[model samples]
Target chain A: MASPEIEELTQALSRLPGLGPRSARRAVLHLLKKRESALEPLLRALDAVNERLVTCSLCGNVDTVDPCGICADPRRDARALCVVEDVADLWALDKSRLFPGRFHVLGGRLSALEGVRPEDLSIDALVARVEAGGIDEVVLAMNATLEGQTTAHYLAERLERFPVRLTQLAHGVPVGGELDYLDEGTLAQALRARRPLG
Target chain B: MASPEIEELTQALSRLPGLGPRSARRAVLHLLKKRESALEPLLRALDAVNERLVTCSLCGNVDTVDPCGICADPRRDARALCVVEDVADLWALDKSRLFPGRFHVLGGRLSALEGVRPEDLSIDALVARVEAGGIDEVVLAMNATLEGQTTAHYLAERLERFPVRLTQLAHGVPVGGELDYLDEGTLAQALRARRPLG
Candidate 1:
């Protein structure tokens, strides 16, 4: 009989972005071996995140509290908004320390094949936030994929009439680059977004 | 002014194998996003493991309870012992289901420069267990590193006086191949251990 515990562990690990069955098995074995030092802490971290972390009500980024540390911080620039595909992308941009603005996590891009539409993203909420008046510029940091481009275009059209400036994160994002692969999509977007830099 | 919480998290994550500062940051971000899905469960698992796990007095393998299941199981063959460098090696052997014997975890190899002497390993205990009688074989499954080889040679010599059979894991470990890199080192060992197909 296949042990359900192992099967569950394998399945759980396999769901990770890069891990597969073999790697999952290896990781599980590592945990089993170093139970006290490695496994215990990992499990604790997992539980803590599950029990305590909440999504920011405004931007959809994860945080220990609603609205997240970034969104809640009054020191951050409210006039600028950085849009990202996922929480991981937000973190990537955060590490660069280039953006003092708040973030909006779209969760994913607009994909016809995947049935992900603009409504499927956080764009509607983003548009509403922008129309509320304080946000001076909305930077489209969505990926360069077909779906990302489509989502960005949709958002651009929706935000066109707003008093705020509408700008797409620029050409620095490689043809196939994902936000995870780009360091500070904010800075790259800023440089490429400069007026008449051409 | 370092936030103690950030410090705690950073230190905890850095302790994980292969996780450097960059990886740890990325991991923390990822955990923050999927807090409920991964973080909470991981935290609970960690606490459970830490609170419940203990080292097997016999083999030094980690388990939720003392005298780990393998060591307590009467069905296992005590006569045939598998000597491995780390508990991870023990798990690999167990997963293969090829060896029904008990195990001895050396904790680490004999690295003279690293000051890991023979006594530092559980070699003495292994020798004592073998000398106590009833043991049919002692298979040295230490890593194929220079230190591992040195340790194995030392064990082979120490156990030579005993009536028990003395054998190693059999080489052909593909020089640079780490134990984790091998799908199943037990299988690889068995194959390399085979004496002429004929």
Candidate 2:
């Protein structure tokens, strides 16, 4: 019932991660209604990102620059490298500001179900980075999912020959998590890795 | 931790309906990963819609051409005018193919809380269209909500002087609705407007 351009716009929007057909239509309507405030800004932003954005050759992270801001920053701890399944995970970890290190995006996890292998990821590059030598620690910051853990374990074996220390994120109850709501595996991990009081 | 362009893109996406900050970030990452297939197509589609889309001066419906497809269509019943609160509603109604007529978008409902008056909508233009003649029926296809009903009532009053038959959508149970799950208001409406068996 809408114009072809509007329908096409809605179809494109629905392909995004969070938006479905219904929501995409609503979003398109909203954009059409507020062309100056919403549509134009979004268009400009998308255009800018599309024109300027580039993948970091060193770590596989996407940014406006070749090496990315994180990789080029002199203040970040180059010795501590964080390996992640995807750029989104890298962004999430970096947003915390707790890991004062650079990142290596694996591009994807080792998914046996989907037939994703180590060869498909940037595993060779990660090993080469560790072997080339300034890195003292390699944090495998993959998600706690089965595939993520499997990838981390595989990476550990590959990087074990190197002089760098290998580690993964600890499994525990979340900060504001209720004990009753906590799952068995998490509670067990949290209890088993109990820390000493200051 | 993302680049400024990427950050701007995420912020713009988050402003869209049904998309929040986290989802927007995920969407941006998805776009970055699939630049060729997803991002480029979306950009092209948005650009096309932005550049070519125009609102129909007569009815406020948006299209690639002036007067819109519905308003310009020779096959459509020009004598039957479907009045809607928004273009989205117009599209929805038209999608059903039940309303074989042209439409007039009121822009928004008459919401006293939001300070939206009749003057703010396309009510004056609607009245002018009716006064110009040839319209036999004016279907007030507003939503069943309080505000929608109020807007329909206001439009009915304004168009009462015209020879056109002013009508509204029936208030009752939906096509596949169950009595157990239905609200009291809907149930009462369904009972009041119940039709005899064939």
Candidate 3:
């Protein structure tokens, strides 16, 4: 029988994205075997992250300090705000190494089908911040999913009254992304959303 | 520019199985966003596992203390032994809820191609323990890989000199393992290894 402690470790590891019971077991076994090499470093990193980490009060992103380095920086464009559904979306945009403005993370998209409503999102804060007048542009950098579109449209409607330019992400096809690799809907939408200059 | 701290965190996360730069970024972002609810718990679990965990000095399996509960327990068969390549192998055997005797982890299999020799393993200790004479049988339960087979054969030959019974794990379709579902190689192996019961 597996010890309760080992079981707990496995369960905890399984909670990570893409990790299942089998993979979790394999990972734990690997960790146990290389306890000094991998596990100790992992443990130390975990503790360090936990003890020092905080959140960006403005964008709801994780950081080691409140407001985060991005939000606190004086040189960043306070006038340009990129709105994304989740912190993943924010990181995706950041990886482009193009955007120089601040971000607003909504945590998740509006999904009436899933009962996620407008009020459940951080849209109110975004609207208030937009009305505060420093923001000149608001880019909806959400995933091109059904819910993502719904949320973007909803936010667009709300921001119509506020004085801010709106835009969306456009560029090369993702590096490892494929057409057959993409679903029918996403492929069709990507084609339809194709722009000139590329 | 991203902070060195954030970069370091991302690098550490990248080392985890299946996590690359993109996945690592997403995970770090998620951890930051759910700092209190998810990240803190993960950090605590990692810390606790590292600080409190130990390995069984005798069997080399991970545990909360040296010798492990299994090795320290008075009821387990100290006389009979089961040999395996990795601690994971031992855990898998344990999961069967069978195998009453204690275990001996060889750390890994012997592979001339990989420069692994018997002397590189715990073979010396295993031989000494077997020679001490209480052991009636030693089961060679190493993996079914080529290296594992070689290790098993070598150990069997070495231990043949001692006054102890030695045997290898039966080669056949695994229990809950199907023939048609088996790959061509495994199917061929199952056929080749067929035996008649007396």
Candidate 4:
């Protein structure tokens, strides 16, 4: 039989997203083969992340430091704060290079079926940031899913006490989207938000 | 944008066999979410592997202890040794729990296209193990692929001078395999090695 250590490593690896038992075994084998190049560095990186990463005090974003790089950067528009569903969504928006503002991460969207509540997310921290002033606009950059919409509506109502103009990602045909392939909801949104010709 | 640590961790995770950039990011986020339960333990496991794991001098298996557990076990049938193409293969066979004998891991198969020579693999070590005596039979448990076949043939010829008996895995339709779905070569082998009806 395979040694318990090998089995343990494989089981741990299988817990990763997109990896199953078979694939985990393969990955473990690959790591053993390239122990110096892949495995050791990965171990070091994991240790660094586990030891150094912390939640940003201002926006609840995962950061190596207290405020995280984005929240701490002075060059970003402090007046515009983009709210996202998760750190992954925040990273995706940042990768697009479209939004040039700070971000606030709400741990997860509201899901009552799964027994998730508003208090389960970082909504209180977000509200605290908005109440502190200086933000001229709050952009709700949550996903288009039902839970995301519910979370967005809830946030819009909650942030009404502040003097900031609240907005959300417009529902319309995405960039490079084809009309025929577009869903009915997107088509309707595009028609409703249609602008006058120049 | 993600911190340098997050980016580095993501990049390192993406190098794993089944994980890609997007999945790696998700994995990093997952680890961050379950730092105490999952991430810390994983880091500890990797550290242990990095600091403790070594190649078994006798069997070429990756082990936390020298000579590995299987090689050190005195109860195993040393007379019947199973030889495999890689540590992955060895682990797979070990998982099957069918073979009760010891093992010899051939780091990789002899591949001509990849410029992999016999000397590049652990074939020499295997020969040395066989020549040391007490091993009455050597089961060539290599893959059925071209390179695996070439390596097996080479080993078979090389071991002809030794007193130990050599045997390769039997070829036929796999268990639960349908004859119509089976390949011609497998069908041919099944016909050639047909046994009397029970």
Candidate 5:
């Protein structure tokens, strides 16, 4: 019923995460209605990102610059390196303003089912960065998933010979979580890793 | 944590309907990761739609052409016209392929609460089209909302003197609707307009 161009636009929008065909159509209509405000700005932003964005050589994070803003920032603690399964994870951690350190994106977790091996990830680069020596701590901030834990274990074994101290994010009940609603595994982990109140 | 350009992109994406900040961030990450397959195609589609799409002067429908594909088609029943509240509604009705007639978009319904008046819509243009003659029936396919009904009544009064026959969509229980789950208003309408056995 819509023009081919409009249909194509809707199809393209539906490819985005969390947006289905019905909502994509609505979004397209909204874009068409507010062409100057929504459509034009989005176009400009996409063009700028597509043209200027590049993956960091030192870390796998994406940024407008090659080294990335986080990697190049002198204020960050260069001694502490955070290893994550993906750039999204890196962004999520950095957005909190905690974790005052540089990041190394592992590209993906080690998944035996999916055939994702150690070489498929940026594990070699991570080890090389740790081996180069100034990093005092390597924090494995991989997700709590089984594959993520496997990847962290593999990285720890490879970096054990290095001078850097290895650590991983603690598994426990989340902040503001209700005890009744949490899974049994989380409850057990929280109990095992209990800390004394200050 | 993200570059200025990526942040701007996420902000722009968040402006879309049905998408919030977190989902928009995820969408941006997906786009950046699949730049060749997803991002470029979306950009190209948006650019094409922005450059070529236009609202039909005759029917108020949006398309790449002046009269729109429906209006330009000689196979459509020009004698029967379907009046809708918005272009989206027109596209939706047309997508079903159930409405064989051409459509006239009123841009929006008459909402006194929202300060939307008859003059604010394409009512005058619609009246002009009906006055041009040859139309036999005008289907008032407005939404079931109070504002939509009010607009339909106003349009009916305006087009009363025209040679065209005015009609409206039948109000009743929707297809596949269970009586237990339906609202009182719909149940009443369905009972009142209940069809006799063949």
Candidate 6:
């Protein structure tokens, strides 16, 4: 089909989150077509991130700077530390602009079956950060999945030595989610955490 | 939140097919995680493709070499020419290894509504390619869409001046397509082109 180089490119692109073989080929062709505006800039950008980007020592977030955007922001409440399962979750919360605080990425959850233990995550470092003081609250903003809950519960017990207040995202139907489509667990939680309506 | 460089990379990657903003960010993170295996190799491959690859003068196919792999292959059937709408189509046909012929990329189809005239495509070069040589057959392997059909018809009429046989791909229920899901036009075509069991 294509040359060895193009095939190599397609192979690399297929490793990405959503792209597969066919879509990788399409992406290569597209990049070739839009060489200057899209491809060149993307190449430069990828190289830049690869060369300069490093994880923030304080929060485990990837950034060019040492402290990352969130950790460095003075306006964000340092006392309100948001704990997430991964970097993607951190970004999602950041995009919403609701959580006016810093973050500590666990790297992953405590999945014993998958061999992901507390040591494998940033639990030690996070506890140390909380133990160092000044953090008034710890937001356990993990997904409502089994792994997420397990990780959250484990962290709560581990961080019991610290005085930080712990909280988790409410389990319920998503904002745009219909009740019919929601699972029974979410319905039950929503019912239990019933709030007064306007 | 991520730094400026990660954001820039995400923005660029989001432009690629199959990647939105969130997926692009995920891809960046994945690359960061698999820096040695996926990221570095991809960067090198992309740069290699950008620096070296060029379109074949004879066939309009993209390749690192001057005449492209297909055009340069001595064993290929030079007399059998397959015409397609774009490089992507050419690659698709080539990947199957079913078409042992050379290719001529039309760049695009004739769209009167979009003001894409015959000149807008590489129709002149294609006509010249057919007019000059000993091409036994011309396979119009365009898509089974209105635009593809229109271009094929126009090319057929134009190539009527030459002594080559012009053909098109058969329209039928795809190999894995279910009978229940097939439309009337396809069903009629399949019935009309039905082959007897040997």
**Per-model TM values vs. the true structure:** 0.74, 0.95, 0.88, 0.91, 0.91, 0.89
**For residues A1-198, what per-residue lDDT tens digits would candidate 5 score against the true structure?**
888899899999999999999999999998988899999999999999999999999999998887888989999999999999988899889989899999999988999899998999999999899989899999999999889988889999999999888999989999999999999999999999999999
Worst 10 residues of 4 chain B by lDDT: B44-53
lDDT string, candidate 2, B18-83, tens digits: 999999999999999999989999999999999999999989999888878899999999999999
Candidate 5 C-alpha lDDT tens digits along B42-124: 99999998999999999999998998999999999999999999899998899999988899999899998999999999999
lDDT of 2 by residue, A1-198 (tens): 888898899999999999999999999999999999999999999999999999999999998888888999999999999999999888889889999989999999999999999999999999999999999999999999889999999999999999998988988989999999988989999999999998
The clash count of every prediction, one per candidate, is: 17, 0, 1, 0, 0, 0
Per-residue lDDT over B79-136 for candidate 4, one digit per residue giving the tens place of the 0 to 100 score: 9999998888887788787888999998888987999998889988889999999999
Q: What is the alpha-carbon lDDT of model 4 when measured against the actual structure?
A: 0.89
Question: Comparing 1 and 5 by TM-score, which wins?
Answer: 5
- Spell out the clash pairs found in candidate 5: none
What CAPRI-style quality would you assign to candidate 1? Answer: incorrect
lDDT of 1 at B175: 64
Docking class of 4: medium
> Model 2: runs farther than 4 Å from truth?
none
The TM-score obtained for chain B of candidate 1 when compared with the true chain B? 0.82
Residue-level lDDT for A51 in candidate 2: 97
Q: A103 in model 1: Cα distance from truth in Å?
A: 3.0
CAPRI grade, predicted model 3: acceptable
Worst 10 residues of 6 chain A by lDDT: A62-71
lDDT of 6 by residue, B46-156 (tens): 998899899888888889888887898999999999999989999878889999889999988888889999998889999999999799899998888889999999999
lDDT of 5 at B14: 100
What overall lDDT goes with each candidate model?
Answer: 0.73, 0.94, 0.78, 0.89, 0.94, 0.89
Model 5 interface root-mean-square deviation: 0.9
